[model samples]
Target: MFLLIRISQQLINGLSIGSIYALIAIGYSLIYSILMFSNFAHSSFLLMGAYTGFYILILLSSSFPLSLLIAMLGSGILAVLIEKIAYKPIRDRGNPTLYFIIASMGISIFFENFIICTIGPRFRSYPRIMQTTFVELGKLNISVMDIYAAVVAIAFLLMLSYLIEKTKVGIAIRAASFDLEVVGLMGVNTNMLISIVFLIAGILAGLAGEFLGVKYTVYPQLGYITNKAYIAAVFGGLGNLKGAVLGSILLGLLEALITGFLSSAMRDIFVFCLLILVLLIKPSGLMGIQKQDKV
Candidate 1:
């Protein structure tokens, strides 16, 4: 019975963290779907969101909802600015995809360094907004924060799903994902659509950042967590939102179980090994469809 309880606890913990990963991976996948390039700068948006929320909480006395909204809005505006200032020029010039990738890397590096230089590279904890409390259920003790995180993550994901699957903009986004050039020719404002995609992606990343900041310390390096999310995105299939969520949950569960039973040291090793195994066995990812090269 004790062992069962331990296992259940780890499972719940895994789900909570996995839900966070899903948030980040979904945003990453959304941008990839429309742009056909990995936005390494996405991590910077996460960093920006974290810092923004941290400052808001510190200054505003733990107004969680206000901080969340402001962080999301700030990050969304930053994303739009990035698109217009950097990516749009590249897009207009009809440069190769490599240029976009390099530009994103540059932007990411700039943000990281900018934060380190200005913020002094020290970790800061968020003020206690939610109590460190636990809920007991059937001999299993679960963290309230964990439960809250999972619930919030699911709620945001559902809203995203509804926006994508039900709205007209979503239909256009789906069409753009298939063939961006064709969509532009079809009278959709491709620029506006792309901006909206970036905005949504940034907003989600910001929310994830706030959750992470509350769960752990806020630091410039906090964005590094997005690496795992990137792996989850690839593991589930890049550009596939459903696959991203599945991959994130599975990865979270694997990490939690491994940490509980084995050692924390083995957790990341196992994750990378799993990534290697997936790439070797199924390069197209578990849910990704293989595409043929145009001759």
Candidate 2:
């Protein structure tokens, strides 16, 4: 019974953490699918979202839901602006892919430093918006925050799936992923489509930032931890939504198990090892495509 309880506890913990990874991975996958390059600046949007949500809760109201909404909107707008300011000019000039990557990296560094200079390097804990009590199930104690995070993550992913699968804009997004040049040639406003994609990615990033802040604490370097989500994206299959989700959950479970049964310090080593193994065995990722077929 004790062993079973331990296992269940790890599973719940994994699910909670994995859900956040999945959220961030979705954004990464979306941008990579269309842009054909990793936008390191995604870290900026996420960190900004965390700080934005934190201030909203502290200054405006302690309403968690309201903070989430505003954070999502704020980050979404920021993402669009970034695309316009940094990425758009390069794209218009038909510059090499390296320029986009360097720009993103610059943006990331700028945001991190800006936060440090403006807010300092100290960590800020979120307000106790939700009770920390646990709900027991047959000797297993489940955290309420874990359940809430998992539920909200799942709900948002579902909504994203629906938008991608059912809506016209979603169809355009899918088409753009396959061939942005072709989509534009087909009369679709490729620029608008790209902005919308960034918007969706920003919204997901905002949710992830806030949830992560609640689970841990808000800090300038929070974006560094998002590297795990990037790894999850590679593990599941870069540019594949389903794969990103699966990879994140699996990585989360693996991390939880390692922390539960092994040393916490070994957790990161194993994660990178797993990533290496995945790349060696299947570079396309567990759920990613191996051909020109795009998600």
Candidate 3:
């Protein structure tokens, strides 16, 4: 009975963390789907959201909903600006994928160092906004914050699904994902569509960032957690939303079980090893479809 309870607890914990990872991975996968490049600068957007939420909570006395909105809006605007100022020019020039990757790396590094230099590299704890109360079910105790995080994450993801599957803009985005050039030629505003994608991605990342800050501490390096999200994106299948979510949940579950049953120290090692195994065995990932290049 005790063992069963323990397993259930870990499953709940895993689902909570996995929801957060799903938020980040979904954003990353969305950008990859449209742009065909990994925006490593996504970490910068996450950092922006974290800091924005932190400052809002500090100054506004823990107005949680307001802080969440402002952080998401701020990050979304920043994403659009970055897309216009940095990435748009590169896309206009028809540069190689390597260039976009390098540029994203540079942007991520710049944000990290800029925050370190200006914000003093200090970690800030979020004020106690959430109740510390736990809801007990049977012999298992579940955290209220975990429930909150999971609910919020699911709500946003559902909204995103509605936008993508039910809206006209979503239709264009889907078309653009297939062949951006063709969509542009068909009179779609490719640039605007791309900007919308960035905005949505940034908004989701910001929400993830706020949750992460509340769960842990807010620091410039907080964005490093997105690395795991990236791995999850790849593990499930890049450019596949369902795949990203599934991969994140599985990864979170694996981590939780490992930490619960074994040592926390071995969790990361096992994660990387799993990644290696996946790459070796199925490079296309669980749900990714192989694409062929035309000669």
TM-score of each: 0.97, 0.96, 0.97
lDDT of 1: 0.90
What's the ranking of the predictions by TM-score, best on top?
3, 1, 2
Tens digit per residue, CA lDDT, model 2, 1-295? 7888898889988888899999999999999999988888888889978999999999987689999989889889989999999999999999988999999999999999999999999999989866477888888777788789889999999999999999999999999988899999999999999999999999999889988888789999999867889899999999999999999999999999999989799998998998999999998999988875546
RMSD of each: 1.2, 2.0, 1.2
Compute the lDDT for candidate 2: 0.91
For model 3, how does the per-residue alpha-carbon lDDT over 143-176 read when each residue is reduced to its tens digit? 8888898999999999999999999999999888
The CA lDDT at 4 in model 3 is 92
List per-prediction Cα lDDT, in the order shown: 0.90, 0.91, 0.91
For residue 101, model 2's alpha carbon misses the true position, in angstroms, by: 1.4
What pairs collide in candidate 2?
none
In Å, residue 295's CA in model 3 sits off its true spot by 2.6
Across 172-223, the per-residue lDDT of candidate 1 in tens digits comes to: 9999988899999999999999999999999989989888998888888888
The global Cα lDDT (0 to 1) of model 3 is 0.91
Q: How close to the true structure is residue 59 of candidate 1, measured as C-alpha lDDT?
A: 85
